[model samples]
Target chain A: MTTMKDIAKVLGLNESTVSRALNNHPYVRPETREKVMEAARRMNYRPNTLARSLATSRSYVVGLVISNIANLFFAEVTKGIEEVADAHGYSVILCDTGRNPAKELKYLDLLARRQVDGIIFMSGRLPAHVVAAIKQQSCPVVTISRDGTRHGIPTVRINNRAEAAKATRYLINLGHRRIGFISGQLDDAESGLPRLEGYRAALEESGIEFDPAIVQEGDFRMESGMRACARIMQAAPRPTAIFAANDEMAIGAMKTLSQLGFKVPADVAVIGFDDTAFATVVTPPLTTIAQPLRMLGTSAMEMLLKLMAGQRLAEIETVLECQLVVRASCGGTGL
Target chain B: MTTMKDIAKVLGLNESTVSRALNNHPYVRPETREKVMEAARRMNYRPNTLARSLATSRSYVVGLVISNIANLFFAEVTKGIEEVADAHGYSVILCDTGRNPAKELKYLDLLARRQVDGIIFMSGRLPAHVVAAIKQQSCPVVTISRDGTRHGIPTVRINNRAEAAKATRYLINLGHRRIGFISGQLDDAESGLPRLEGYRAALEESGIEFDPAIVQEGDFRMESGMRACARIMQAAPRPTAIFAANDEMAIGAMKTLSQLGFKVPADVAVIGFDDTAFATVVTPPLTTIAQPLRMLGTSAMEMLLKLMAGQRLAEIETVLECQLVVRASCGGTGL
Candidate 1:
């Protein structure tokens, strides 16, 4: 690592003179500054950002705590966050929790110790201890999940309940009376419960009975979706339509349906949420609720940047819209 | 944000004494250390790792420069890296380049400025300037891509040529004589060209004539795959099977084949590489070569750790095995 001292030695100047020249301080002559810059560039001397951050009180790094790395949806969000952060001259510390509480807390503590400028919490639910940890940090924290705004933290997300209701209503309009629902972790008030409530509300509006037996719980994973589909299939008279909270589970349900010799949209229709890349690649091309995944990430990062700059947030929660992406899986024309 | 001075004030002790006690200096009494620890905890004071790193010369951070974040294959690799890094008490700085040369260079400089302890370069091909940048860095760098080892940098990856040959052989054994090949970025010596060479080698070994007309170049993206597949299909008599450099392309090829009214494994069998999650979820599934994506990440990180610890690597390049995962897409039984 080339340092100011190394440049000074090469130029036969005082280290402080080299530092002033590099920082473009008025005390240093322009010719000397030019000479110092040339030498620094030739020696590949990178400014020590970590040490400089101590004086500036700005690390220019944001910690993104994602719940799972395997879930492809987060990948899009991460992309959006990286683009915004990079344009702002910020680097991201990716802390994948993989839904482990211990790992999540450890990463939060690590970020605190490292003194990151801010954090973007992108997880399903915010635990109390995690909230406490965020509160303890003097740095601003913005969340790209559903529940964070409840704690008064700036949040960026879509209205899961309304989007889910739209999906259910779309299915209802397609003339499906009995619809099986695959709910995410039911305890996740920000994610699962609200979506479930939306499904129920849509059913009530359509004058269709909401049957608990036809609804199965999934962990928002493919395997859980497969298992839930199997369970839902066992319900007497089997629902003609299924709406999964997310695309992964919906694909899992479709896989199970395929194995059972059922044709999608003919024997059983399927709908999914979060129109991730998988939605388009699936056999029938899944009809899903397309949440502004990348926008959510960019919006959260922008809000965090504002908060970090000590600016007041015009809106505490930025709720992006979700659109129904109609495809073959739901027996609908592309929409 | 609590500082040692705050803890000292709370405990009615000198700040220097509190610092020494917190550091557990041998000169400090055990009782005084305990009192300082309790006070620090009560005040929620976190020892600034940035300042501590300046003294220790260890950032406890590793920079992972990925070419693309949207590629699901890298997600598994990141998960593996994160798990190992977390266990080693190191944080990961995720630098996504999005395949832009300027962005890649910028991130490399950022990692250098931040003084990351080491770096894991994950990209298709290592450009000459990137190699130069790595060489100039004081910290160790291990690449998880193909060509980094050519510059004598430690690398961890599957032998692209050999793995592609295996995929080609699998298809050959299934009685496909006219096999169309969809290559990745052809200039990527570490990724694209080697895989293309492998396909040629497999054809030669099987005494099957390699026809140039059926081979099309792709950029390793789904759109490229679709375009390449369409081009390849324009060949006279149409190749009976297609082998894509990666799964995304393979899925795209399948999509194109379906649009052309061709039945997979019946009209035109399709195989892919890097059996990603999409391989299984796609209709009819996909038969492809499965690289130990996660293990590659773990291996590169572990090797970088060794290099950072000043240990000599027994092997300059660690080559993992790639297996053929046979499924419905190729009309083949499980391997």
Candidate 2:
């Protein structure tokens, strides 16, 4: 509770001198600063951070909006973001939108009002106009795991199309002539469109006709995938292999296939994206496309910090690669 | 950027009247309040949250100090906290200490500086003195998954000892006499001592002699379980059953034992605490104790909010029960 006045009275110096010393103003003598610091530490003095923030216009805090913390993918990415943010003396305010855009917008408003230095948007489908309004507030906003290039916001993401294509090609090379695709909800902004496009491109390149009947839309939930798989299986001459946009969906599909008396790989091979923790634990394991999730988070934080410091970012889009981890689910080996 | 002065000028009123009306003060006429609100909205006026915070001393934000988000148990618990916090119009700032008390202290300092209205400490070994120091700052601190009753801070946690005893008793009823125990990190505030105590209590009730050599310490990690399982396996008259404090350790032990050519339930039975997602997916499907993780999160937030509202809190502890989920891992019929 010690203020500048108390320090000044104790040191027999004017309040202005005490304030300058405490603020580390260059005008204050080094000797004065040393005496003031020693006295402050001795008295167990703590500065009024709220009052200081009002004057400095900096809270040294960043806002991170994620869909769900329980999702291992998001958790890993958050770890990456935390490391980068903490190293720079910045803390993150976490807002879980629960995949609700309205909630995401509400948090955005709250973060803006709180005057966060920057924001890292991870997952969730935030409306374009809402993002624009945030940018208009003059705070740096970096979008992660989603391509926000059209909005001109700095974005860090994986090459979803390329990774999807690679996964599809791998399936094709395994002698699967007919392939079914399970797509995530198109409204998810980052997950659905590019991956679906990649799936199409792979089929086109291989001289195979794109069959709309074989593709089912899923909301990225396990239940959605379960139902989608059931529908795909009921289709005439069901595809020999299935590619899900994410591991959760792929696992759901695998579970459904198992219940329906289909032997994975021997009957219908399965592959998933995101290489989440469940990717390895599911029966027959799972072959997955691994997004550099941690790197994506790290890059997002780094880019946001750079922008906050008034540095020009080299590119609006930062893309990392994905790896294909082949396991038993793709008709490979043990769990 | 429109301020009260701008609104006042447009409304032909004093800044004080505009401010009062905008704040919805009862003294202001309802008509005036409506006019002020309409003008503010039309002008896209956003209040300076930092300045308002300085005056009101309420940031409408809470701080969450967690050990790690990658742990599925913690992640689920966090999700519950988010649900309640968001509903109550409070944002949560997340600080992951990565199980380091020094880092936890640093984050506590940061949270204090940020002026979060309250804090929820989740599964971290924070010294009591640290909790006292935090409480001294006049911020409501609620420790979840850790005992903070003596520190006068509200706590929300499952009855770990009772849950552990139940899990052990279940194994005992299954005709297993020789059971090995894997203890979580001793430093981990919750889950360690209480779980071990519960394990011992169950053995005592069954009139079984406590075997110190059969107990192994694990850091609540899968790799640690693997090492501990190896050590236990080499013991004279190896245990026919193993109980891990958590699912990760249980799965690790199962994987190691299986690799060593032991058939689960037939050669060695395993049970884990915290029925995480992996518990069901792993081969032999782990039978474990299930904590109401999400409810714990919600209750913690509610308690913190109540404390922040100046309500006199009743006894600072809120203990929930845990359920024992039977699965193939515990030598139970999958049916």
Q: Evaluate model 1 with DockQ and give the value.
A: 0.74
**Per-residue lDDT of model 2, residues B1-335, tens digit only:** 67789999999989889988977778998888889899999998877777887788888888888888777888898899888998987888888889888888787777777778998987466586677666776688998877687676689888888999999999898888899999998765577878999999999999998888889999888889888998989888889999999988898898789778898889999999998788866766789999888889999999988999989788689999888888888776432
Stretches of candidate 2 off by over 4 Å are: A126-129, A174-178, A186-189, A208-215, A227-241, A257-269, A331-335, B128-132, B174-178, B186-189, B208-215, B230-241, B257-269, B283-285, B327-335
Alpha-carbon shift of residue B298 in model 1 (angstroms)? 0.5
lDDT of each: 0.89, 0.85
True contacts kept of each: 0.81, 0.71
Cα lDDT of model 1 by residue, A7-79, tens digit: 9999999989997888878988889999999999899788999888887878999999998776788988998
lDDT of 1 at A212: 92
Question: Cα lDDT for residue B87, model 2?
Answer: 90
lDDT of 1: 0.89
Number of the top lDDT candidate:
1
Docking quality category of candidate 2 according to DockQ thresholds: medium
